[model samples]
Target chain A: MTKNILLSAKGLSKSFGGIKAVNNATIELKSGSITGLIGPNGAGKTTLFNLLANFYTPDRGEVIFASKPIHQLPTHKIARQGMVRTFQVARVLSRLSVLENMLLAPQKQTGENIIKVWLDRKTIKKEEKLNREKAMSILESVGLDSKAKDYAGALSGGQRKLLEIARTLMSDPKLILLDEPAAGVNPTLINQICDHIVNWNKAGISFLIIEHNMDVIMSLCDRIWVLAEGSNLADGTPEEIQNNPHVLEAYLGQ
Target chain B: MLNFIINLSNNSGYIVSLTILTSVFAIFALGLNLQWGFSGLINFGHIAFMTIGAYTTVMLSLSGVPLIVAVIIGAGLAALLGFFIGISTLRLREDYLAIVTIGVSELVRLVANNEEWLTRGVQGVRRYQIPFVDWEPGILGKVIAIALLTGIAIFAQWQLLRGIKNQFKEYRSVQNKSYQPTKPIVCIIWGAIATIVILFIYINGIISLYNYHYQAGLMVLALLILALVYSGLEILVRSPWGRVIKAIREDEEIARALGKNVFFYKLQAFMLGGAIAGVAGSFYAWQLNAVYPTSFEPLQTFNAWIIVVVGGAGNNPGTILGAIIFWTYDAVTRFLLPQLGIDNARLSALRIMVIGLILMILVMWRPQGILGKKEELTLGK
Candidate 1:
């Protein structure tokens, strides 16, 4: 009873217009675990992420994160409560410098306060330096600190994705719902990103990566769930999921 | 040479007056720069703020409130109006908001003209008090002017020394200029504004020192406005915050996710910009020695919108430059074009028609205006 469930979504159902996008979807993610969700195109994988992230609240179901019901909360509120989500297409604040993009992530930012900035000069500088250092380390870990001053818009697609990860870390997030981290990234960088995720998971950050690449999911996910037509099709280990007849028939279509 | 000296001396008054007056409006333009330029907030009713400032200042002063207090009251009232309008309409789709603001501004003008007891209606408020005329102008006036100038200089220096944001750069309304270019034309505009201020200080010094008469001050005020516009734009463009404003303009949802309270920031921009408009209106009242609702018409707000758009939406310096360019054309056209046998009243209509045509062309040929970044204009994907 005291197993410490990090996230639990039960009987979640949602529809866009008249079409059911997610129905009867249920999942339990344990604290400090790496979970992967995979489904083919139109399998409602991204929509499920959107629902959990509060981009669209489920028409029916309860979502509990860290034991708090988060169904009615806004996406930003969810983010503030140590749960951040990334977009499938990559959402970068394109006009800002890479440093600015990183600086924006840390929740309850101290720099935006007009009074604090004017009154507490020494303290602000110290905190700013520390945050900058953390952001630099994250960027450097992701191989992006060299371009910290560059405009985020000018970066390549893969680099932007990496920057998003670096940005998410600034919040010291408890959970990250990555839509498709390896979607358009190079094969070489794909492994690097996966390795980082595995390492971060080892350090106690939970992640639910929605990946289409079977190999990456097999290598990274502790457990995998497959969805087809807004319904749960299969759930098991990498080897078990690969040979699930229902998953092969409906999702993989193999 | 004697005639030349006399002409220069006499003409200096009008030139200084115009420059200073222009600067005042430039300040107003900077306010608009903050709202529309920085945050992509379209405040089509900007002139209403000016009207509120002018009327409030004049009415309060005429009612026996201290001059400085009245000025503060006037600006405060204008800012209040801005806050209300921003709160109500900022949530609407931008195009709808533009239409609503234009209508609200018109309503304000109509109410001002009709409020006979309070505003004097068509008669307008007159014989208002002028601020800072404690002595006769000429040689002695220079000392007073110099003293005030030194005080301001010392204050600015002290504040900067203490590391407080000098001139409230953070509070100043910004315009979007991200990725367009590093050099904000506002710097040049400020230089132009400064050159005018120096000219006024020079002439107002020997010609009429310590005077600080309303009109002379008004003239200098305009140049001051111009300088504020110039510097405000430059400082905003170069700042990290200015980049954030442009990001909102480019993509609101993105800014929102990045921990920017997009709605609140936009609201702040609107109120600040509106307050600046109030300052412009106050100066206008000072220049004419009067205030009324008719002076702050919807057309005036529309004209500013045109100025911003024609000059360039994301360019604050462009707005100042556009205001001058447009006003000069109006002055010249109203004066010179009529000599070619065109009716004077029709010239006003003609000017508006030309503005409409220019906006059309700009939207068609280059929707981003003369100096705007295309990305800034794109809104979002």
Candidate 2:
């Protein structure tokens, strides 16, 4: 496929002692594309995601994000470069309210000088107003507008998922890697989440989603990459992947 | 009727003195409360900050610097100590921090005791300049000076509380979680505290200025204010930052993942709290009319912790309440213990024994103390 390269991981291999968790796995995430990574448990799909996001230093790999080599960068530094990831289990700042949860995500706020915040009350009040307006609008986009007053912990499982998505959006991400976005979500909420992914894709934010739902995997992903036992099984269109005998065998424990 | 009136008036001064002294300790407790109650920074060496405040004021005063400058120096030293303590420990985990802190406070006491040149060795610094003493003219002057100090302190506290409230309001979550800020409720409470502080100062000033008996009345009024000061401290910890501390207490790693920079916030809170503890120490110095190295012992810091845990670990109001109840019982016991079956030396030991037993019982049965949330009490389970 002819595409602008957004992130390319070459010769990625990592091991714990004698165990090769992710061995010589390489993948390319092209710009403006929704990609699917599917595999059974222990397939190193999440591990690969971790390595790609710079959470773990790969034993050997080169991660090029936004055309810069980011393998040695810290996780937050990687996130600041517009490549962010969401964990499988939703982690929200439980103390802050839902709105606060969203606001804290966009740590790029420039107006929050502690001295200026305390001393110059007027500037703080004005900044606060503007920040609130922006926060509310973003909350509206994620269907969490009404829950702005709610503590983050009080949100339901699906809402927390939406909150995680909202949090990533607050970072104004160019690319997102979701590790099991629809794992515990109800079907209806899962559809809402899928719709959001599709909408974000339309708005030019690319995603690499690890989804267990076969229907979700087949319908949305522009291209699919299947992994088996820490190795790439196949990479193709969803239809081509579904028809591939190798993918069938991998699923059937061959 | 005249005799009774005279008796009431004498007792009222003692009451006032008690209030002022209590206020000083209450202020110390409040600072400690903010550290323990809001941010969960285990500041075991709280009185070290207090010692800094006391020694600074006394040393500066003895050196012939103006009293205002000395007070400022004292406050500055306290804040400096706070900054140092905060930087050293706020990064590490809680228990390790606590152990180090307990050790650090004792080291401060040891330094204060041994350093004869600085703290006059074990004897401490005396003949320290008192605020508004030269201004203690007629009844009105004394009254005015006391009122001015009280008013200024209450006002500064009012402003400080306002800033804290604004910080709380920035990310406030719950309804009953009322921050002790410039809210109408807080205003009314401050108003009441101001009234009491003013009344104590005004009344004491009148008698002392007229009768030419000043020093003792000041001590009496200082002790009476123990409740108000700590209660105010309790209120701040119930604010949003307080909740953040509790969140940290519950699961700090989660707080970190949410981009809260749990370490930094904890440090800021720790320093602010230490500064407050310093203020308390200074205030105690003021109450005592002289500061000695022996006064800022580790026992004072640990005593505040005992007050916090015995009252309730995470509950602010409970600790304040604990302070008043404990101090009053302490005062009564100090007087009554000597009268009862115990010798004078053993009487001191009894207070320690009683404090230990109370702490032990509270830990064994009601680990969360009186007002704390159950989760605030940590067990390995």
Candidate 3:
């Protein structure tokens, strides 16, 4: 609990019409820790993730990543600042090959520029070779190396989920906010995903994971934060959170 | 046999003209491919770019600017317009681009139609000097140019094949336990056939058969431009830049999440497509020997779209084939319908109807198009 803060959101709030989706929600992700965010459906967990990642601008909040104010930064700018997020439904480019999806995730690719792609052909090709090697190694780790040439649309739901996580490795981010990584995934893959998360955490990549599945949260999360009705309900270790009365009441009420 | 040969040679000028037209449209559709096919940017006003290109080139050249400078400026202007349009609309949903582009295109047409001082109004611009118009190439000169262009085309094809083989070598080897030389062999055979055809055509003095003295030079120019644009697009589409554009097309949010500036890539694609269209516009103006406000009508945009759709949205070879098919149908129907006693107005309508029917059938049975890969289409369904 005494770890250095990697990312933190303060006094974040957003509203749609008359409804306050996320109100005064504050959260912190410690460096090299696997944090879990849990709530019932429509508890504004995703909304909070959006705010933290700058996908949605908060009405009144400040996000600091690596001690730099990032609330004003765009989503891509925030990502470049060493924090990235994945969707609840894995948003892979289905038309592209699995390897293409991986290759697209890296930042600052020289070939990303139209002029550079033509003018800097040698540099681009060299960089691409290096990127492909990195992507293949990452795909190997996720057991998707064989499907590198396959269209991503051909992937199963679990494999797409695995690919989503694998893609984040290409960016070499300090923190990754995963939105419902275990949702709709098969049990075996769920275990595998948790194992990968643990391994990634051990390798110095911090994670803030949102999961409806309590088993994944209990096993993988170092500490858990519970949201109820767009506000913080409880925060503690998995054991303490399980016994928290308000957390139990909120889930029961839902 | 002698009469038949004479007749074929007599109509060869018309054939060359038709070929030039088809190649110009192929270039147009290639631009569309970069925008809609690869980047998923909807540009219903693509004709606007073509208009900007053609008019700018003609206007500049007529005002005493060098032909090459005029063409470069024309393309640059079109690209600048594309950049502005992209900045204004790319941040919104995809349909906004379609709407804005169509409106802008119509606005450009109207401006060209009414502006007498700049564009000469409805009278249109005519007889601007095309590149190499003064230099009447002899048979030997023509053959040399043809050979040089063909050599570039073949080298481009070989490089493409080698790149594909290198990129997918591991996957292919893994999929098929034995490595087959099928792809390279096929490519080499095709290259050889192309070389023989070029040599045969040039050696037999077929190039002299065109009635118009400028026809050979213009055709060669068009072919050279087409080859350069096609190869350029092929390289870009296979590069890392292309992957990012495809990713943006698939899901802008995901691309942004991965730290890519989605707007930036979209703008780049739009501008590049516009620049290519501008180049096509210059060729088009030369083909007709005129630049009319009516020529850049909305129908022109639809023609390019139809070509792209029929050929294979993302497939460049399919686009070229689609252009050839479309123009051949148009030419054949024009002659046949008149011979069958149809008036000009009715024949035109009927021609459109036939195209519509063909498109309908294609959509129903093969929406991915003649050469399009099914997996590449990002259809919602």
Candidate 4:
């Protein structure tokens, strides 16, 4: 079955003090598909994610999300536009409870408005009850329901990654940019995450993942994009990329 | 009742005045708590709002506006100042906000000092309208006012007793559930403190019935305002709006990634906190009986910080407790230090040194402040 493009970045470039971090890199994500971004250290893979999400502005580029140009928008605005990204180190509010971390992700919260917090308390309370129930169910799915009352800081490294991904689900995103979801995570947990991602993809959520685990990437990604030294080296099916000489050379070095 | 209060006031006027000062500073530090404790805005120039509120309210009252309306306007103007400062610095970084706020407060003080036509220069503004100053209550009015004061005193005592009872109940319940040999020392300490506080309030209430003057009335009003503000803030910090700000404080990037407008929320906390401090400034001006340029000093801002740090940054009750303890120290030292053979200048310096020592010890041992939770302490982290 054919799928339409969900996100497209054209001619993206960024430089810091005369060093081009991401040079003329272009990538696309199809709706209802899992895409992989793979590169060696300092190959500008993370920089590309930052640019696409508007964490860092590109000197020359236009990004279209769901058929709308979002490069000019703020990072929060882009996330509100149904695209969210996660950090490589799995950032969580250490002081907040695990349930609160999930509760913070929903957009257009009535209780977030200061005046409504006091004036329309009944509605806010109802909304809070609904959000809490939803958060609990999501936590239960990830087996984090038992630790909902615990601080996010107390979670294991792998659990923190899962929490971060689960938090994005609360925002109802169409596309999620996950930065190294499998990095530093134990092998058993990595497979568990891969399964969750495939299930989420089947439920119509698109993903762009960066991973050092080649087995996880090749098995999960429908298509792959390779970056080397701030430029795109190859883009193809996993089997094609595995056979491509340029992709092998970029990883092994000449 | 009036005669009884007047006689009692003859001996305890100093304590009554000190309580007024503590209450005003508590209100001031509460505003700082909302900004720094909960939102993590790093507002070092909190006194600027106080200065604006005092000057604006006094100037407006002198020009014939109603006292309450003048105070409201003062708070509004302070919030406006917050808006300007927040727009410029909130989008940048916390350290930048700190530098800008400190500089802006200094700028505000300088303007008050130089703008002779507006602020009357260093001489300061005097003889503004004091709230409830002109009322000459007859016999019936005095009886009603005394009765009201007595009723409030009784109510406060009842609450304290009930609180003590509840604490004991919970203590036993915890032991039953956990089966641990938990010590009762903390509970006993709390009960003793509550008893002392109850006795203090009763003494003040009895004295105020005789005094019945503007200053005594101001103390009651100030305490009432402090209670209201504290309760309001308590509710706010537990709300979803507060959750967003707490999130912003810990990691704004995560908040932004979750689609929250981080800059907007920071600006809101800044303006609201400034507005609260402005209200505190009005109470301060009333207590001082004059609004002076030197009154709003950089040192005054640090006084609020000391109260917040000593009490607990994120806890409202802790801020109030800090203010009470701090002012009690000031009052005690004022009389005692002079008797210790030290000159006025040295005595003042020594007082500050002692406070500094206490602060250092508290930082090392009880870094979360007296009332703060051990696990939730985020200082320096």
Q: Pick the candidate with the highest lDDT.
A: 4
Q: Against the true structure, what is each candidate's TM-score?
A: 0.83, 0.76, 0.92, 0.92
TM-score evaluated only on chain B, model 2: 0.74
> Residue A214 of candidate 3: its Cα lDDT?
92
Q: What is the C-alpha RMSD of each candidate to the true structure, in Å?
A: 5.6, 6.1, 3.6, 3.5
lDDT (10s digit) by residue, model 2, range A19-124:
8888888788789999999987888998899898766789997988878899997555677788878888887655456776666555444333333433465654
Question: In model 3, which regions exceed 4 Å deviation?
Answer: A1-3, B1-8, B138-140, B152-206, B209-212, B378-381
Cα lDDT over the full model 1: 0.72
Ranking by DockQ: 3, 4, 1, 2
Better candidate by TM-score, 1 or 2:
1
Q: How high is the DockQ of candidate 2?
A: 0.26
Candidate chain B TM-scores, in order: 0.77, 0.74, 0.86, 0.89
Instruction: Please give the C-alpha DockQ score of model 1.
Output: 0.33
lDDT of 4 by residue, B25-47 (tens): 99999999999999999999999
TM-score of chain A of each: 0.95, 0.92, 0.97, 0.98
Residue B285 Cα positional deviation in candidate 2, in Å, after optimal superposition: 3.0
Write candidate 1's Cα lDDT for B1-381 as tens digits: 677547756665665566555556667777787788778787788888888888888888888998678877777888898788878877777887788778878888888888788788988888887664453566665565655544433433342233223213422422232343423344345445645534444544334334345455555445545555455555544443454566677666666555566666677667767877887777778776776566776667767777777668767756766776666666666668777787768877887787678778889997876656555445333
- Candidate 4 on A1-254: residue-level lDDT in tens? 13499999989999999999999998988999999999989999999999999999999989999989999998889889999999988998987889999999988889899988778889888988999999999899888998887778778889999999999998889999999999889999998899899998999999999999999999999999999889888999999999999988889989
Maximum-DockQ candidate: 3
User: How many clashes in each structure?
Assistant: 19, 23, 0, 2
List per-prediction Cα lDDT, in the order shown. 0.72, 0.70, 0.85, 0.87
True contacts kept of each: 0.16, 0.07, 0.70, 0.62
As a whole number from 0 to 100, the lDDT of residue B27 in candidate 3 is 94
